[model samples]
Target: MKGGKIGESGGLTFWLASPGDYDDVMAISDGIYEGNDYLPHRYHSWMTEPYRVVILAKRDGKLVGLASGLIVDGGSTVFLEGMRVCSREQGRGFAGVIQRFTDQYIRQLYPNVRMKRLVRGEDPRPEKLAKFSLLAKRAILSLQIEAKAFHAFLSTLRAKLEHETGTGSLEQESRLVVLEEEQLRHILLDPGVSSQIELPGHMIIQDWQPLKLVESNFEVLRRRNLTWLADSLEQPTFLSLHTPPYPIPYKGGSFRFSIDLFGTKADLACRALLAHMEMVRGAPQLFQDPQTGGTCC
Candidate 1:
């Protein structure tokens, strides 16, 4: 697999993943997440049922960069997960080439997929990772922050998409993700995603409250859902957000958190609550300007 010349690095290649390429793929994966923690093991499990792709960049005879992704639902959706370039090959536009090629490749493979989802971890500067002597565990938390930021950014982009399509409700147009206590327990205990987290089920939800977004000035509507939960000390709280298609005048977003009588620890729940609130606060910033679209639509 190859892409046309762009920016600095020229003549990039795109290729499909094979059983034999697992070692090389693993090598690239190690380089990408060498010290990062918090990333679920499922993030690196490529042999799963979903389709996978590996796009490699080479200059002369040595590898310079690589990209890995998966096709969900017969290529209707593409998830660009991991991407990295060699240490010596920095500063060039090779990263962009990999991204563009992956986007084009998915479109060519699955014409029905209305959109593509790509996520890059928090460490934008690969060079810093090599120079910093930070503990591996701390580095992982940094990576988690990056993952959360990426996820929140994606959520914001979904909101923008609703506005562009003239949808009445951004929440309705975008997928609503439910993270219930039962579901959280499953996620933390499930072998698939939980095994990666040492503190899986231990991270309790302390509180949950509802969220709402009233139309204000922006033509774009806000995206909120009843999918999040806040765990309380004695009970688990269910948090939900109800958003209008467009901003409601004079009324800010309204949300409710249904606290369960029987839940988890207070500190754990509060941490989760704060994280969700922060996400809600940042989500709308992407739509602050009506004239701009930031990879969401």
Candidate 2:
């Protein structure tokens, strides 16, 4: 793949990644992730995958960042697999440059695919939720219950149905209600019913619009820089970027939940969290601001 230069500084260059770039990419990933479980370990496989696109960014002949995207759902959806920037090189607007270029490259390569990613968070801070709403426009609560808990709830519902209809077990009852995934999603999203489930885990699931290349947004990001972005947030409180060994608030017990922001600002927090999600799975368009209930450009 051909390489191109980015930024007016004349130091940054970007190119499609190959297996040969694995070592350099991993070095950057290692520095940024620092043994974090969220680091991607399948760079070689991604380099060879027909539906995957990996982009590497270099500055002064040194690897500075790497990003990858994949075509999923049989070519109907494009997922950003991961992205990483060198520890020392971060906060310099390289992320926005790399992301914007990669997004455009992916769309050109797969014009027919829609872009989407899953954003999962448990009891997210109000600021984070607001930022997500600005980007995704839609969010749902996900309730994950233990199998035993779910079975108990199902059994009780089944018993009630059987009593009312004078039917046998659900397997033999023609009128039995079999809850589909959509029904569960609906129930979890419904505020009235959501609190009643009392599931072990609660998370907000954001369904973002397909990714698109917006030169204007990237240009704004580049000019203003991450520091400016950080200072722009309405609420500047700090939070931890690490996930816990287990989801918190177990059994409604008071558990100490803390995020050590280390003085990072809200915009950086938003970017870091979203970028972390991309490494594990992982938008653009005017979205409705959840806080203001107004459209965000």
Clashes of each: 35, 2
Runs with alpha carbons beyond 4 Å of true place in candidate 1? 1-9, 26-34, 37-44, 72-76, 120-297
In model 2, the Cα lDDT at residue 178 comes to 22
The global Cα lDDT (0 to 1) of model 2 is: 0.44
CA error at residue 232 for candidate 2, angstroms: 50
Which candidate number would show the highest TM-score if scored against the true structure? 2
lDDT of 1: 0.40
* C-alpha local distance difference test of each model: 0.40, 0.44
TM-score, structure 1 vs. true: 0.39
Query: TM-scores across all candidates?
Result: 0.39, 0.40
* lDDT by residue (tens digit), candidate 2, 1-297: 333443322356777777677667666765332232233444555656566777888887888887777665456666675777888888989878887777777777788876445333345678756654433323332333432243354456546655764645433532112233333334334444323322112222112213222322223222211211111122222212222221122332111111212232433343333333222121111112222221100
Model 1, range 1-297, lDDT digits (tens) per residue?
Answer: 323332323575555544455455444444333333111232334433335665666666456766666554334556565577766676787888877777776676667766454333354366755644322121111111222245665456555544665665543432324465445444433433312332323222121111011121001111122334333212223222222112111111212222221123433333343344445444554345453222111
**Error of model 2, residue 108, in angstroms:** 0.7
